[model samples]
Target: MATSNLDLADIQATVLRYRPEPYYGTHVLLRIDDARGGREFLRRLVPHVASAADWWLRDDAWIAVTLSYAGLVALGTPEQSLRSFPASFREGMAARAEHLVDVGLNGPQNWEPPFGSSQVHVALSIFSGDQLKWRQAVETAWAQFRDLRGVTLLMSQDFGAQPGDRNSLGYKDTIGQPAIEGSGVEPLPGQGRPIKAGEFVLGYPGETGVVLTMPQPDLLGRNGTYVGLRKYQSRVGAFNRFLRENANTAEERELLAAKLMGRWRSGAPLTLAPERDDPAIGADPRRNNDFDYANDAHGYQVPFGAHMRRMNPRDTRLAQLTDVNLHRIIRRSTTYGAPYDPDALSERDDEIPRGLYFIALSAKLMDTFEFLQREWINKGDFMTLGRERDPTVGLQENDAVFTIPKHPVRRRIHGIETFNVLRGGEYLFMPSLSALRWLANLGG
Candidate 1:
């Protein structure tokens, strides 16, 4: 049987659109007050929601909305309808609260906020090239709920900076994302294969050659996806201190940082340019993500437990696993707070906040996002590297150590302090464009 074509008009733009034209974004977390009022708010907001078809035509700005599992129920979705959604979404991030702590998600208790808590309901994402324009749009949207008394804005974060792509640790970030088969974006050279669209979008065939069972009533499930949003607080002082302690010269420190991340600060991968940083390769999209772990299987070039390797491991041989593509996900991250200055670390008396707002998208939350966190990131046994964790983002204890395999003998770095601290986050369901309309009409 022939598969049907994807309805771009029915899909949300964020599900397929990789980059939003180098724009600034603001994420607003909302709590629904009244069911009827909330539905009315959705009714008013649906027309402004961007669709997959709008990605090509628009160049200036866009907006998208996703509902938490609680948000769906608050909008008057039936209990039976809610049951069809994934357990991860329905249970929220609190369900995995314990494991999250084990993986360094435990930050200051007061900073937890209402994100993964019961208070959070809806998420509104606005993107625009002009910061003023995006802020105006957000204010206009917030006005609709003000009079209705239907929704309350829980928290908001403004993301993106001038020349706005670098993360807090100051590396050229947002590279190495896989292209979906039908997303109109071509895969970078050496990206292996275009990931199955169904892996990230509903109503499509995934890596397992299955369409992934969707919720009944096509409007609600087709073209929908799931998201995991996390805020990481970067410890610049600790990172600089680690490098100073580990390496003697500035050159060695740079090399050590590159090995730890599997990529140079210029965004170049070590697998391709193991000897030194190559600005030319990092600048070229064709050459950047082209290399895999097949040639450097022993972790000589790129360490086995590097952040990039643990996250993807593309083409790397795993025990009893032929294809690791099933675990791939699309990441859309933005840095928060000001850039950190290593030289001023000692004199900086006050607490200066800076890190990343990490956003990950996938069709199945458990198989892709959660699995990567638990198996690959938090643990290292699968990669044949004993108890060592990811050097870049892993939860580092006093005994934490990272091994860099060399021809003669491996080099080990010990007492690696955790640099990225999790502050707040949540699991949300980004529904289809048609589903947004359905939600608006519900209980009317």
Candidate 2:
């Protein structure tokens, strides 16, 4: 099916669209004290929730609303309907800690307030490219909930976030969100054939040529999708220190950075411009994400264990080759905290609280998002690298080390500490506009 047949107007915009032209973002978690007020909150916010219509157009701002399992219960969803969701989502991010490798410093016990707690029921997010438009949209959402006594704001993170698609780590990101089969936007260079709509939106046929079970009472699940919200605190100082310890000259440090990531800081893929930083190619959307790893099988240009290469591994032969598209998730990641401060380290090793607000969208969170964190990010057996994790964002073992493939000999860089710490995370279900109404009218 093409873009025309898809129910664009019913699906939430965040599911298919990137909230694009990205510049700023906000994440607000809410607690529902009463079922009636929770339903009313959804009712009032329904009109404002963005739809996936004309996804390519440049919207100044967009609002997104999603509910946790607790949020659904607070709205009084039928128990049978509640059981319809996957155990992964029903259990939520904190409960599935061991499976997600959220241990040690990244444990849920250390998570920011209300993130892993059941107190957080609803999630509201606002993204804008314009300040004035962003404020209006945020105020509009606040107006919806402020008057309700049963609804209370739990926490809000990310304001005036980093712009131009650059992450706090200083490398360019948001480069590889897969294209959906019927998302209407023209597929960019590296976004292989658009993924099946069912792979993303609920109630559609996936790549397996089957529709995975949707939540009961079709109104609740159709046109909806699961979301995994993660707040990462980037250890910029540690990251900077790692580079300095590994290399001597500025040029060598940059090359190591490129080797760690699969791209230059400018978003240029190392596969395309291996020897030096190519600002022109990095800035060009057409060419930046187009190249594949097939040509550099040995990972001489792009290390096999590089962050992007591990997350994507485009055209690279895997020991167990599975359809890469099956594991793809749409990432609308945004950066937060003070702009990338190089000197952000304190004597206590307490780095600045700045990192990416990782928003992942997929119909099958277990198969796509969870699987990536498990097999692709935390382990390297699939890539034929024993016990090696993703060098950039993966959970690193205490004695973790990174290996860079070179011509004569491989360069092994040790002290590969975790750069991105999981401050908190949660699983949410973003309902379609119609589903929001269905929720609003429930038990009314």
Candidate 3:
């Protein structure tokens, strides 16, 4: 009988190169199921792990192989030159028992069935830093593990700098991100999203509110959330030209840009220090999270419908939604493109290549993704006065370009236009590594 197991030694070798933390480059996401014989397979796989700190320590880290379901099928084609393992491994898998759920890309929405069902996943990074050294290590690792065939390397173009680097979005990204721990004020103790008991032990003690919990009996350490990735292509030059043509004064243009983003390009929020950019408050953990748009009479510091305000409005008195934290997502956006030049500012040529790979992890895509897109980013009438638009990410209906007349103190901004586009993306599930391997060798 054909078996669904691969040589673990081969898999282990491919995994050893990514050690020493601070992952180098090239992210690999694997979605897996628990092999028929479960705990024994996990026991066999645990010794081969590359990072002890990452594998065991981190709350989100996992030992299972994982991937989006569609992503796994892509590796199944003949062109990949895949080889299968012997029948004996399947015997081992069938003996040990554990949960099996598709970790990524469910069917109907995801396409095709017999997709691996267990929710184990693993995300790893491939490197290019030391050139020959990195290549040598990768080759050595590949020689050992290529036979496993469950793993797929994402091969990121670059790690890309953390949040602030300008993506195609035409503005600095990832500003006002919350601290992992100390924010001075206590975090609201809300059991925002509830997962089953088993999931809590797998990897998500805190992921409850970040990802929606599922109903199936075996949470299998795969509950409490969803992960979304959007690659946005920005028209940078178009934005610059629009600013020049619209605002009467340079100060007026800068203020408008700041209002759209909720913070200045320098990382300052308009709410705290409205008149001027405050790099100090922008960088501070205490003040940034503490801001609510309760007292901005001028609307100069931060407008009511600015992307930040619409996404995380500080106005506690205005009881419009269930809770503010319900919509909060942990953003991990990376900018892709060249630095903007002053000379290029005047060129209205639309060929500039820039944008952001927007990644957000949340408990519910409904609140985090839908709310932001429909209610805030794409909402034409987000504000009661019909004044502000999400300057950076707003989409105009029927491709209509309308203007938001200026505040009383500020001059009118005219000739405004929509400057970005959402190319394409699908919702993805990120599972721990153990889940990834089970899917890779599922059919035998």
Best by TM-score: 2
What Cα-based lDDT does every candidate model obtain? 0.77, 0.84, 0.42
Candidate 3 ranges with C-alpha deviation above 4 Å: 1-66, 72-156, 162-171, 178-212, 215-224, 248-252, 285-288, 316-322, 346-349, 380-382, 385-389, 398-412, 437-444
Top-lDDT structure, candidate number: 2
Mark the regions of model 1 whose C-alpha exceeds 4 Å error after superposition: 1-4, 20-22, 56-59, 99-111, 162-164, 320-322, 344-351
Candidate 3: global Cα-lDDT? 0.42
What is the C-alpha local distance difference test score of candidate 1? Answer: 0.77
**Candidate 2: tens digits of C-alpha lDDT, residues 301-355:** 9988998988888799999779887888888888888677545544233356778
Q: Give candidate 2's whole-model lDDT.
A: 0.84
Ranked by lDDT from best down, the candidates are: 2, 1, 3
Please identify which of the two predictions, 1 or 2, would achieve the higher lDDT against the true structure: 2
lDDT of 3 by residue, 1-444 (tens): 122122222222122111212222333334433233222333344443433222122112222232332443343412222122112111111111111111122112232212122221333334332444445544543443344444333332344432443444435555543322211222322212322222222223333433233312222224323445444556667677776666678777776677667777655677666777776765554564456555764455565556676666644333344545445665655555555542355445444655555666543442356566655565545454353445566654333343333455544444445565554333444333444344334445
TM per candidate comes to 0.93, 0.97, 0.61
**RMSD to the hidden true structure, all candidates:** 2.8, 1.7, 11.8
How far does residue 420 in candidate 3 sit from its true spot (Å)?
2.4
